[model samples]
Target: MENKEVIEPEILKQVAKILKVPVQAIKNFSEEAAVNIISNTFSDESVAYTEYYKYTINPFEKWVDAMDKNEQLFKELLKSEREKIELPEKLLNEKKGNK
Candidate 1:
């Protein structure tokens, strides 16, 4: 018997499902065709061209911008809290003055 690379049937089925082809097609592929599939799947330019990578290239940028906006909002909230604390203190001081 000739030596052949033995891929799991389940793995071939998943690959076929992903490729939208039948498992038998994968099983029947020639070595060159198999190489072509692998090259097409992960070519050097694939990362730059894949739709998912387009959004992920700078994933942290959105997070950092959101964090900055939150920081600004937190500063405003802190200022409002300081104002609220001062309001009661001012009212108490005025009551003392009236005594």
Candidate 2:
């Protein structure tokens, strides 16, 4: 609703849902309470650690494979650049020899 009266309660309820707390607890969010909630949530080792990360296959191996591909691509690019530079150099040398 456009009115603060209607929107404030809804906002508080939504915030409570996100925080996993009751609306009553968030109606008056003090600094100390906020700090305590944050500290408690973060003290746990798995605040946002999902199951996907836990069950993933060899991550380092995948990273190494990607790096190998990147290295190969870079080597190809380097060779192409060297050919471009050498082409100009060879053309200049041929012109000098002709003159």
Candidate 3:
């Protein structure tokens, strides 16, 4: 029987789910080499991209860092929106009277 091959994105997503790590952490070596590279990276965590002569990055770390930076921006946006909402005193009184 011929052996079946696993593809890159599928292996990456599955490993991320199983390891609770992140899809970005896994790099696809190639369409055909995906399974082998995944097994090596998971076991050693030191697999290098020979073409680049450096270790590949897990993308999730960069994503997390970016989100962290955006937190302050989001907080400022929410605060600005809240400050811009001006409730007239008459409207406030009317709402209280209705209640």
Candidate 4:
């Protein structure tokens, strides 16, 4: 796989503003630390909501349990429906000699 540049300093500065942290902190973060910081910062509300649902409403667990009950049916459907999906002509013809 090719390693492409994904982040720019300006983008990091903007993210720092959203996260309410110093841009230098983001700039100094290692890749893994930066990913964790961004995820935790942005997903605080989502984490709280998930916790609330898990404890108070608990719908997600019920949904997962229901899905687990029908897992075999889902697997069988997936197996029986296996077929090669077609790619667009342009993609298929990207390399010469392709039919």
Summarize candidate 2's per-residue lDDT along 12-61 as a digit string, tens digits: 78878998998877666588987887899986754687767457688899
- Top candidate on lDDT is 2
After superposition, which runs of candidate 3 have C-alpha atoms over 4 Å from their true positions? 1-56, 86-99
In terms of lDDT, model 3 sits at 0.72
Better of 1 and 3 by lDDT: 1
RMSD in Å for model 3:
14.8
* Candidate scoring better on lDDT of 1 and 2: 2
Residue 84's lDDT within candidate 1 is 100
TM-score of each: 0.42, 0.44, 0.30, 0.25
lDDT of 3 at 12: 63
Best by TM-score: 2
Model 4, runs deviating above 4 Å:
1-6, 31-99
Candidate 1's C-alpha lDDT? 0.82
Mind sharing the TM-score for model 2? 0.44
Clash counts for the predictions, in order: 0, 0, 2, 0
Model 1 scores a TM of 0.42
lDDT of 3 by residue, 1-99 (tens): 025465477866887799887676544335558777777787674765467665578799989988988998899998987766655656788899999
lDDT of 4 by residue, 1-99 (tens): 025356777877788999999998866769888688779877565444554465665799989988997997888777766633334544566755554
lDDT on C-alpha atoms for all candidate structures: 0.82, 0.83, 0.72, 0.71
